[model samples]
Target: MKKFVLFSVVFLSLILVSILFAIFSFSLLFSQDSGVKEFEENFNIRLPRGTVSEKIYDDYSGFHNDGVKLYKFVFTPKGMKSFVSYIEKQKDWEKLPLSQSYQALIYGGEVKDFSGNVTGFGGFAKEVGLPKISSGYWKAIGDKSVITARFIDYENLDIKTLINLNSYDFYLAIYDTKKGILYMFHINT
Candidate 1:
């Protein structure tokens, strides 16, 4: 009789503990901000409806204490239109003109110096860990794409200027209409 009572008591205590743990876990899961909501809050922009894919990359270099946050997303063609429209309405965002070298900014390509010498360059898409697209892919679809930024020197879109920036807040968004991809890259130094 004693052993039976003791077993019953232990079983009840375990059940009670399990119930409490479940309640605590559920509260935490629901109360915390979700990834999509957090992304919107951080970037000051909402993900358009039908945004299908999201890739976020964050890194803080221990050597220089510099950090970068990159977000790459795939949107439906319709969703891309809606997002571009919404971004266009924002006061901070300025639509960039399609320059001959715009593709080199987001997609890896050869860069040229002021002297017209071939200079090395890197692209944001690869930095953000997005899938590699072939060279000239963006250039081929350039006419249909749209780019906007908080600020960038349209004339001096070179690696030197980008590397020389100091303590700047830069926001760039590129919409590849052909592939329905959106790339948002922000640099904080």
Candidate 2:
């Protein structure tokens, strides 16, 4: 009876240790830092230091929009500038033209006509200046069955610029006319 009790205790301890080891191994395999590493490798740009969030989704499926894996990295002012500089160094990126109408909106000017012309009103342009870069007229096509969907009227700007690297199109739109935040997206075509 004494021998059986001792063996039972030993067996239970081994099982517990095995469970703990497996948990640790699984966690190490899927650590968040690994996501950051993967992002840097895929984009060829170092992620700015700040809060980073990641989501993996099926392509064009469900409520989650765009990319098989989406990573949003929000940065401080300094980090934003650093990232902007990094993008500026890329060979294929170019400054996108800002239309007069879009400029008016950015500067808080009223749109007098539907021609999309900029009519500056306040000094918002002088104060805030233009966003560093904006890009894309992103058509978020959710359903293929809908043939007659009206396109949302928004001035598409290339915030930083656009680049085609390794058969993938990269767009970095730092400012949304509505949201007024820095963001980026890429598509592999």
Candidate 2 lands at a TM-score of 0.39
Candidate 1 has its poorest 10 consecutive residues by lDDT at: 136-145
Winning candidate number (lDDT) = 1
Give the per-residue Cα lDDT of candidate 2 at 81. Answer: 71
- Candidate 2: the clashing residue pairs are 100-118, 133-159, 133-160, 134-157, 134-158, 134-159, 135-157, 135-158, 135-159
TM-score (all chains, Cα) for each model: 0.48, 0.39
**Backbone steric clashes in candidate 2, count:** 9
Best by TM-score: 1
Q: Report the lDDT tens digits of candidate 2 across residue range 1-189.
A: 999999999999999999999999999976766555655554456767763544332254524343333334455667667766765665543344345433442334554444454343441233323333455222111122222211222223221211111122222233232332333333322
Candidate 2 structure lDDT:
0.42
lDDT of each: 0.54, 0.42
- lDDT by residue (63-90, candidate 1, tens digit) is 4444556666766667777876776666
